[model samples]
Target: MGKKKFHKIFISMLSFILIFSFLQPSQASANEGLKINADAAILVEAETGKVLYAKNPDKVLGVASMTKMMTEYLVLEAIKEKKIKWDQTYEVSEYVYKVSQDRNLSNVPLKIGEKYTVRELFEAMTIYSANGATIALAEKVAGSEVEFVKLMNKKAKELGLKGYKFVNSSGLNNKDLKGMHPSNSGPEDENVMSARSTAKLAYELIQTFPELLEITSTPKKIFREGTDDQIKMDNWNWMLPSLVFAYEGMDGLKTGTTDFAGFCFTGTAKKKGMRLISVVMNATDENGKGTYNSRFIETKKLLDFGFNQFELKEIFPKNYEVKGHKTVSVVKGKEKEVKVHSKEPFKMVVKSTDHEKYSPKFQPNTELLNDKKQIVAPIKKGETVGYLAVQAKERESLGYLTKEEANKARVEVVTTQSVEKANWFILALRGIGGFFGDVWSSIVSTVKSWF
Candidate 1:
């Protein structure tokens, strides 16, 4: 064969192999073989918000009682900000009392003209999915459920949640609110969000207040214990370690169910120093009917896929420097260039087989650079010069719950040593040397062209 033709054929074959490698399925995508059996589902790493698996992730659907997770988050914020106290009591409103009396809804009966403390009501709402308790806490925080729904929407925006709308504090259909739905929504409107948004909410809640696990992990509790108003409250999260569908590392979260919302769950579990959050919306049985257990079954499949197929792998160690990107040019400094390295190790939860697929995407701090893309003198040791972001070398990415999280999936690049300004004499000498070098290079190039 001719040399030119042989080289062309070899290059063509190489191009095909490179393209084929990227087209192959990633370990997380391989979960496609594992059916989730839900309308919308997502699994993410709690620490990094890395999405390990998804099914119809962006499809908006009724959240049912899972709306209480927002209520829970707001109440916790209220307590933290001193807007409300846990021991503070609220008198039962007629609306709350009427809602509590309904047997069709999950609730702890609240007598007319009676009062309940914030802690008592919060427990009832979170553990038992009590709609009345949820409303009661909502009122305590915002003075009324109507106003609380506004706060829910406001906070959802603040948290960067997308594809979400809160019609009521509880996830109950607005029709079940007895004509007392939030003024901004229709009477039949039920709180709804996409699986991805739901997971993001859960991620924010856990990261902000990890102590919530203490209450959510509770299997059973007595509301108003040893009182005439006392009621036995059992947590609806069957996947808790103490519950029937107990899975190792399973902990606190929320569950929701309504005729309109069907069955939904937001669950989290920590095992082997890694935590995962999973959201399953409108889970159904083989017959295509929503069942109480179907949510847990679907959640189990997601969590199992995460724990079994993925693991925390440190792709880059602390202080590691990227090839061809280890140094930043300095202007008027003792050193012409300063070495930079990552502030922390880059760790991610990914399948072992996929570790090689990710590479460092270095982003220099443009603000710190001048016209020549060089830093001004006197750079301090450990000073941030840029960021080292992780990017999939190919098109296949496990993804993240939020774009913000994706942007933040990076480590700081800092200077290795302080750089002092060069002495005036040295600077002058360097300038003279550079002028001579440039003149010499120009004359040499002109002579070579003539030759």
Candidate 2:
């Protein structure tokens, strides 16, 4: 064969191999082999807000009681902002009175003239998914549910939530125009939200009110304890331990069901010090296993996938102590080097089985003092010299992330002790020693040449 023809044939074969290699599946994050029977679904890590898994995540649909999550967010904001108090009592309006006792809805047994503390109502709303309780809390925050829903829509905008709209504080669709929001144009007005928006709201909700897990993580709670009106309420999320669909590390969020929004769940779980939020919308009533409530089943799938697929690699343990190679050198100071301590733990999330494929780079020694050329003396004790940042790189097929987008954690690097400037006498001695060291080297080189 001619030399040119031989080269052409070789290049063709090499190109095919390269293309075929690229087509091979990446084991870092697998999307197949797990079937999620939901219209829209998403899974995200709380710390990084990194989306791990998604399926038609942005499609908009009615979210039913999941609207209560936003209602809970606003109510908590009101309490923290001192707009209301936990001990304060709210008069049970006729709206709440009727709605709470509605046989068609999930509600608390409420008396028309009876008053309840803010804490009681809040718990009833979150723990039991009480429509009237959430509406009551909404009314407490705003003048009425109509006004409260405006706040919800405003907050949604602030969160950059698109393809979603809130028509009511509770997720109920109103059949009467009197019960409709100002934005409602027709009788049927159900709150609409995409799974992505719902997940984003869940993420922000947890970040803002971390204490919410205390209320939501409970398997069961009793309102009006030790009273005639006492009603023991159980959580709708069966993911809690000892439940029919119990799962370890499963805590909360909310569940929803309606003719339009069939069996939806926005759930959170914490395992191995890592927290993840998963949202499954419009899940079928059956998993084809004769097991009803497919929302919880699919949620378990997502959460299990998240926990099993990712591992938290702790670069520095929480409340870390300075020891070993975790130290940075100090120049021209009283001490030649000082131990570096992390102000907070640094961790990176990576594929559980692909830890070896990542290369984490932490900089404090290198990037100290705004990438300082030299850290001079007179550094104060507990002074922030630099920051420790950790990044992990691995391969994944996520289009949102680059080929090596790694999880990052950062914390300040502080000086353990003051580093005073070296005295003039010490500087002079070092200069003399350095001068003699150079002279000795020159003499030694000359003597060896003579030999």
Candidate 3:
């Protein structure tokens, strides 16, 4: 080939390769223009469990009072298990009352020996962010704050939260004032959690105790012992507008702030069967007013992107038949043929442009029974024998097994007989004699009737 032609061909091939590579999807380009705090952030679809966005989500950070989400989760579990009654009165212990007495502490101000019901304590802890109320409720439910912290850690591990540690029911920093430790081993600087774990914990709490919103979403509540005496408290979340907006589905969740943790919030909103959880941590005050507009605005942007950009589509309805499996052999069965069907629906979300690209694939067990076309004796209906998976182009959405339909298999039996040659003539003679005897008896009976 000429040198000029060779050079042109090589350049064209290289151009094609570069174009194809650029056309392929990359994570960085897919997430462009979404802004977040430098510390950590995550956005997730609660129903589909799809991670819509994440930024340093796994990085560990002090979560401050967001720890109360887990505390509230355990409390709901206790209620569901009937371990404590909603109206059960608990006497305020001296320890809890002393903690409440801290002027700096956000508390419900339970006096020593005074009693309050579990419901009142939960409202104060979850709505008012009352530290003393949380500790009291933890001790009342788990016998001690130490035991409750253990429960929180166990639940965290169970939920696969790897970057979390709990030293107390309330997420109070225990930094030493003198900046000196006896051995640097006592509590190991007990910081609470990360944005990913905090969002997950909030989601679980809402699912477990949806009734919490009935208290948290209220703009104000007045707790009073008598007609004239009352203490009124207002909600900390400012996103909930007094007048409903397009995002009226917004509901109750927790907010946190500390000098180290700097204005964090976990917010949940739902619309049209879809729910989303958004978290932001370590947001700097954008206006230099020590306000949390950074957290609020960034969270609003992420939530708006999620709610506006995507939707859930049922690619496959539950129990919808995909295709039949090849016949399998059954041992000790009559007729041979068994069909496989799906046990549940398959579904996924796709861009409105990509919905037509979805398809399903069936995978079945090829091992045949003795009969080679049917299942073995006593094969029950609705038993899963294979799986069906739905996909969007190359991405798989959901996979589940196909089951047998009702009364699809039956038993078949066979029998055979043979006569020896020597008995053949005797059998023929006896057959002719019996035929003549039957004719003679019929004639005699007819004659007797006539007489």
Candidate 4:
């Protein structure tokens, strides 16, 4: 009997220790050499929309054809709402023809008055990033480029992209530099957004229409399919395994570059059921060469960092046990205290650097539980008196804790067990016990302070 009692006490102490251990601060040294050279960059998880890593994430810059992703987003949203049909044939406008005729710019020139379905135009815009096709879809959707841009800005605002702005449905800029191909031309229109804001836009894209990957992930395609009018092209995201910088699992999103934007890419990849989104904007050569490789290499580095430095951890396993028993006061319980647990398991993505101080955090809702000091009676079996929340935290080498949202991640928790109401005699006994307990605890605290 003595051994059994000791074992129970040991278990209780261990549970208590484990629960509070999470409150102990933990930290790791951040490597200064890990920084990437980009005007701005951000890495995020597609599902949770968590910012995994960032560098100058809020620095606003022009996003060349990456603007096409938003254009495609609006285009797809239109199709989903049935405002336009994918297979429905549409006319090529004079504006589209003029933009298509730019010999220096990539295009799938639509013969004036020659009609094509929405699907054809969308394919050209997404795969080839044909500026003319982009403008055509914009005009088809909103009646004109000017109007489509309004819809783009409105959509950007709705996505919580507060600092983003769109000047045109097609991302052509308004610079008149003679040496550059597709130099910004007329009315000073260019799609501009910060790297962080850009990631938010990309996150919403996959979250809303995940199947859009079917098209974006395509490495190469024939624009007109079997007709002699077909135009074959490769995807701009050269990260695909079939092309250069083949980081395994890289599917699709978009890439943009111009004399002004430099080079930018929003890439997403999936490995073992986990998907990550990475964005790099305005990556330029250290020597001022301004090659496209800088953005691709830096993006690969970012994804590698995300996949290597962090991993998903199930903080609370299925039927996980959290020992929470209060024997202090039950206003009217048959017995003195009650035990509680969670009905479901909780899980969250944990960074490898933050794993040492993991713990289960309890966020009991006293408002609904009706008891902060002591339990009020009339408790029913299977009632939720409180919640068990598990949070992910990591200390920074700066000798400081990161703000709650930035450093801590939380998981879902619910209740399992319930307490029953006690009789009047039991309630009286509990009241007396609680009063003495409080007195004893205060006296103990006072005595400890003297030591």
The number of the candidate with the highest TM-score is 1
lDDT of 4 at 304: 84
Candidate 1 residue lDDT tens string, 193-273: 999899999999999999999999999998898988888888888888877899999987999888787888999999877
- Highest lDDT, which number? 1
Clashing pairs in 2: none
lDDT of 3: 0.63
Off by over 4 Å in 2: 1-30, 157-163, 176-186, 221-232, 285-292, 316-342, 362-387, 390-408, 414-451
lDDT by candidate, in order shown: 0.85, 0.75, 0.63, 0.71
lDDT of 4 at 163: 65
- What candidate 3 gets wrong by more than 4 Å, as runs, is 1-26, 175-188, 225-229, 243-246, 285-290, 324-335, 363-377, 394-451
Candidate no. 2 TM-score: 0.72
Once superposed on the true structure, which residue ranges of model 1 sit more than 4 Å away at CA? 1-30, 370-373, 391-395, 447-451
Write one digit per residue (lDDT tens) for candidate 2, span 96-207.
Answer: 7777777578888788788889899999989988877887888899988778978999999887677888888878766522353445434676789998789889988998
Clashes of each: 0, 0, 9, 9
lDDT, candidate 3, at 37 = 51
Better of 1 and 3 by lDDT: 1
